[model samples]
Target chain A: MHPAPSVIFFSVLSGAGFGLLTLLGFGARATSQGWPAFVFFAVGFVLAVGGLLSATLHLANPKNAIYSFSQWRTSWLSREGISAVAALSLMGLYAALIIFFDIRVAPLGYVAGALCLFTVFTTAMIYTQIKAVPRWHQPLATPALFLSYALTGGALLAGAVAHAGFLFLLTALIQLWHWNGGDKAFRNAGTNMNTATGLKGAVRQFESPHTGDNYLLKEMVYVVGRKHAFKLRIIALLFAALIPSFMMLGEVKHLGALIAVALYFTGTFASRWLFFAEAEHVVGLYYGKR
Target chain B: MTALPETTQTKLGLVIDLDTCVGCHACVVSCKGWNTENYGAPLSDMDPYGQAEGTFLNRVHSYEVVPDLGTAQTVHFPKSCLHCEDAPCVTVCPTGASYKRTEDGIVLVNEDACMGCGLCAWACPYGARELDQAAGVMKKCTLCVDRIYNENLPEEDREPACVRTCPAGARHFGDLGDPDSDVSQLVAERGGIDLMPEQGTKPTNKYLPPRPKDTLDTDIDVLGPLLAPVAEQPKGFLGWLDRALEKL
Candidate 1:
């Protein structure tokens, strides 16, 4: 569960991008807070597309990624792809309409908004559906991620600041609750040495399967300290939710708004890092790394 | 194609016996040697000599099992892909690259279509799948699909490399789907159990547990306390030893 920097970047950047796009979809566009409609839309698009492109950074065959769009029927990953493409296209059309002809279609905005929400939902499901990583597989994961995206995106967008802030606080509390639950999830996941090997009686790893580092150890066995995680969680709560909530109460129409968004990004990045680092894969039991 | 068959025509898998495996790693090496050359792409290795860490489809792990009241035994456990009836690896593949064969039920990765997202490796509970860092693709035991189905090879050698090279005769290859098959019968007689049955993967592979030991059943003569040595004990060698000891 090593959090590849590229994936971490993709999740945080694309989340903010999609969040901004979701806000743009309501036809309540804003040119205030040093974010022009065109620039805003462009930045959001770039972040989403950039995040998508970044995900391919780890791919062995990036060329074959196009074929990935084919399995939308079964895979959550494919569903995410299709949703992202469709959402991006709808947002493109909406932006084009607003930019080119000085027109605004509320229905198109709503359509893009709905699709945007679906895209993020699919993204969250991609991790939640993985039963091996019990930490992410929970009933609370999807809503927590969805609310996080909306709150962050809403801050970058305009109107409903109070509503989004309140939701952000709720989700932030849930994130902390979910974070605590993840530790218990690994403990209560009920996977141990005996279960892994299907053997009876007391079993301990006398020797590792390999003498040196291998693919499984390199990829799955990530060890982050609990103390460090707690500190980061508090930092994430402070910037991602608390301070942003306080900022929403103040007049954050210009510089204050940018500062708030910056703080939120920093906070979200910390949480996302924990999301991967804390994930205990079942395979780790064999090596006694869990 | 990511969807598994309603029922596989043949559940082709290996039944590994833990009681006999000596942790020799012959099957591991033979598996690596055969699949690296036979398969679609080479099992890529980074710093294959300096790091000497190469992709291995089969891995032999040795563990010390100490029961509450019995002596400990070292068991060598060989693990690979179980090619489950409901393989999450295939379903999670965003592309139709990962699939289970309808003809033989050997789960395989279509390298041409694989994007190497490494999600399949993560989905697998048993550390069966591996990401080839050199090739930038996910690699795993293919049940030696290339060798198992190769008509060029002799009929006797049409088994997986691991089965053929296992010096201890710990690994067996056959269709586990048929109740009358040798492997199926072996499972019935030996009570071979699946690894992590709770995951509900319904793994085709089975591991035969180590045989129970009888601690109190010994046939050797028990030793008793010796009488004090006589002053004029025994003959030539015994006399010399006694004299030598008296001199000391």
Candidate 2:
């Protein structure tokens, strides 16, 4: 569970982007048309697309990314790619109709909004479906946390400060729950060195296959100290939830909202890093790591 | 195409004998050598002379097992792709690159289609797949698909490199799908077990558990009579010498 920067940025940024797009599709009014609408939609597009582009950085051969859209029937990653593209395309069209033609297609907006949320769900499923990592295998918690982050971030950007504050608190609670449950997920996964090796008694790894690190060790067996994780959790909560929540709830004006957004982004970034770093892959049991 | 086939015509896998592995990594080396040259992508090395990290399709791990009733035993566990019946690695591939052959039941990665997103590696519970840093594609044990089906070499040489190179005869390769197959019978006889059955991947590969140790009776010495004197005094010339020495 390597806390890869590209994936972290991709998930957090795109989650927020889709969240904003979902709001725009469903809540665009007459007064919010033209230049203002264009600006908001533009930001959404940049964040969504740019986040996707960053995700390609995680791929060693991104040139073959086009093929990634072909396996939606089985692969959550494929479903995610298709869903994101569909959501973005539909939202882009919906935005154009409202921003340029000054026409609001209610049905299109509703469909696009639903698709946007579905895209986030698919993105979350990419992690959730992995049985190897018990912490990320939460069918409910993983998606809930992702959606909460999206909605809260989206609400803040849409200037619904009160709504954003409420959502932020909810998200913080979910984050706490996820972290608390994740701490014990691996131990409770029923996988140990004995089960991994199918040995009768207490099994300990006497010798590893390689003297140096391998891809499996590097990618899945990443170890973060508990003390550092605790400190980062505090930082994540303080910036991502408490500070932003209080600021927005207190009806902070223009400058304060922008600062809140920055702080929230920083916090979400830390949270996303922990999402990967703390996850224990079952393969580690074979190595006697977990 | 990432969807698994309902049933494979044949389940070809390995039956590894843990009792006889001897902790020698010859299979690991032979697998690397054969696969690097023959497979879709050469198993690459990052710092061969210095760090010495490289991609290996097969690896041998040694474990110290302390049984409740017996002395601790060292077991050599050689691991590679199990080629599960319901292979998660295949299903998790965003591209149709990872797939199980409906014909032979061998799971393989189409290097041409692989984007190296590494979702497949993440999905595998056994840590079977490895992303080649140099080729930018996922690599795993193909069960020697090329060698097994190829009519190019001698018939006797048509097995996985690891199985062929195992000096201890710990590795057996054949169709496990057929109950009458040699490997299947070996598994049946030896009470071979899957790696992690709880995961429910339904792995095709099986490992023969190490035989129980310290079963011999240590209290009674079988060599006691052989080490004891044949007579109370000494026999023949030794008796005469003992008597003369006693007189002196």
Q: Please give the range of 10 consecutive residues that has the lowest summed lDDT in model 1 chain B.
A: B220-229
Q: For each candidate, what's the DockQ?
A: 0.60, 0.77
Tens digits of lDDT, candidate 2, A1-290: 99898999999999888888888888743368899989988888888888999999999988888999999899889999999999998998999998889988888988998898899898899899998999998888899989988887888787777688898899899999899888888777787787789899889999988899999998999986544888899989999888898887576888998998999899999898999988989998878885
The candidate that wins on DockQ is 2
**Model 2 alpha-carbon drift over 4 Å, by segment:** A28-30, B227-248
Range of the 10 consecutive residues with the lowest summed lDDT in candidate 1 chain A: A27-36
List each model's interface RMSD.
1.1, 0.7
Task: Evaluate model 2 with DockQ and give the value.
Answer: 0.77
lDDT of 1 by residue, A1-290 (tens): 89888888888888778877888886555343223567778877998889888988967778889999998878989999999999999999988877766677879989998898788888888888887888987767545775575546554554457665775677587787787777788667777788788777789888988887898887888875545988888888887878888878766677887787788788888888888888888898888776
True contacts kept of 2: 0.83
Model 1 misplacement above 4 A: A30-35, A224-227, B215-248
The pairs that clash in candidate 2 are A1-A220
Task: Report iRMS (Å) of candidate 1.
Answer: 1.1
Question: What TM-score, over all chains together, does every model reach?
Answer: 0.92, 0.95
Per-model B-chain TM-score: 0.86, 0.90
